[model samples]
Target: MRNKPPYALSSVDHALHLAALLQQEGPMRVTDAAERLGVAVSTAHRLLAMLVYRDFAEQGPDRRYRPGKVLRPAAASAAPVALLRELCLPELRTLMERTQESANLMVPAGAEVRFIATAESPQVLRGGDRVGRSLPAHCVSGGKTILAALPPTELDALYSEDDSVDLPRLRRELALVRERGFAINDQLTETGLTAVGMAIKDAGGSPVAALSLALPTARFDRERLPGWVGALSSAVAKVEAALSAR
Candidate 1:
């Protein structure tokens, strides 16, 4: 029988145990994680956040933790996630430079969107890098932009399985997003954050990901939104062109 080491770090042990639970037992809520690990809710949340940052876990639309890329079985082909991040970094940087706000590259993962790369603004009061973070598809600018591109039936089917969002409200917002060819999040995910996003489509005319610019809510100017969206759209176009070339 394997014995626990006397010097085993409890925090590391807890994180590993949590990862094991996600991999073997599937998705679990933070409360369930806390109960299983015998830790406080805040402690469990911190552990899960660390796992998410390391790609050992991801939070879904239902806000349950699940095994991430690092824990999942190997894919048949080269993982596109890495390639997308690499190819989009330059564009993200350009967008950040143009808008003076943080730029991010995200891809839809089921009913959630995962932040894979970020280029942070140099301003002292700017939005920070959000790489490795995940949020519900209906809650963030990039997620909404990606979702707005979905086929009507597919979009309806996706939210039908999850009851956390207001279907009618999301539908209305997505309709506006489609009309404008971009999406905006005004303190939707975090209280002080605002973001604008546009979809990046492949040569086949299918959206593969989204590019967004996030700023502090205090700095958001509706008067300047058109300029910001224009810059974001240009960056997306460049990224899409590169993807097509590849």
Candidate 2:
């Protein structure tokens, strides 16, 4: 019988290395994995597919891959989630105290935003924003901050041809956000609730999450929105810096 090629052994080694890297790092793309492994694109793609099939990794809507539940048992548990909580809690508390509004730390999950952590205000009319709640990505301030950070090509791919072709308007709005360093949703997600948000970029300047403050429209004065925006922006900067420094 013919001897098995050395490439097969190399492929197995590369896949194991990639899996270990994903467990250590956060989410990444196939190209990123290939670059890190110094392997061909096709090889990385195959490895990722196998990992996904075996439930060792999960693919996000943006095509990035993250470690799946199957890998959680062997890996150190609770550290990643605890790190997120520890980093976000103080900022969320500050935002709540400053604005007297609900504050949240949201991350992209598939096509929606998931509230990883939240701090509720003591106001009588506070909106109850709970953790683990998922919301449409296009309809919330936090979601908009994340969506606006995506490249034009990725943004275009997000919307369908039959859907509202409002690319020009969207681009203009995002440009304004780029200038202002934040995003706003005026009763977009729910009636009488307005939110202001800032994106949280990782060390590489990629938007990994967003932070936002939500208040009732009755108390959302246009004149006072700037102050809230500033508060949220400051909180976001501090959190991003802390995360990047780690």
Candidate 3:
């Protein structure tokens, strides 16, 4: 039998319990979750909201919470992910310092991308830390950058399985990304947020992750895009070199 820690945090325990419920029991209403967890409805809502934000749970069309992608079984191991974050954080911090914008490191997860680390900008109006967040691959700058680096057959196979994706349109955008050697997401992932991204290649020239600079759309001057791309390229180079050395 597993023993609970003496100093167990009630909030954390509640959230984990909620995640277990969602993963094992499938979708549930807020009221039902509150009853099952023996917490107030408002507390349950807050807990579910946190889960949604972390990609552990998602609210469905019927307003019921269901297990999200993070809860699904995956072949990827956590060790490499942790190492990737460790290797790239310094560069992310440097990029943030140089660009004065939030820098993020992300890796593709099927049709979506997961932000593993972030160096939040010190600016008053800037994108906040988004670690653990997941977004559609075809929508975000980093996602597109990584996708563009994918082999043609792999890219085609990936999008072919998803009916919702417009493969042709995505291919056209990716063509532009390939031509420019960078991708730009202009208020595509979130309103008022824009990001520039470049791929981080491994020793064999395969892209394993992407780096992005996210900022408020209002401050995303096209004239500054070249500078942002240059910063991201520099950060990616450092991260790639570290990965290669490792």
Give the alpha-carbon lDDT of every model.
Answer: 0.86, 0.79, 0.88
lDDT of candidate 2 at residue 1, scale 0 to 100: 94
RMSD in Å for candidate 3, one decimal?
A: 2.3
What are the models' TM-scores?
0.72, 0.64, 0.89
lDDT value, candidate 1, whole model = 0.86
| Count of clashes, each model | 0, 0, 0
RMSD of each: 6.3, 14.1, 2.3
How far does residue 165 in candidate 2 sit from its true spot (Å)? 6.6
Pick the winner on TM-score between candidates 1 and 2. Answer: 1
lDDT of candidate 2 vs native? Answer: 0.79
Give the best candidate by TM-score: 3
> What is the per-residue lDDT of model 2 for residues 89-111, given as tens digits with 9 covering 90 to 100?
99999999988899998887544
Candidate 3, residue 36: how far the Cα is off, in Å: 1.6
Give the range where candidate 3 is weakest over 10 consecutive residues by summed lDDT: 72-81
Model 1 per-residue lDDT tens digits across residues 106-216? 887777787889999999998877776667778889889888988888788878767787788888999999999999889988899999988888788776789889999
What are the runs in model 1 whose C-alpha is more than 4 Å off? 1-79
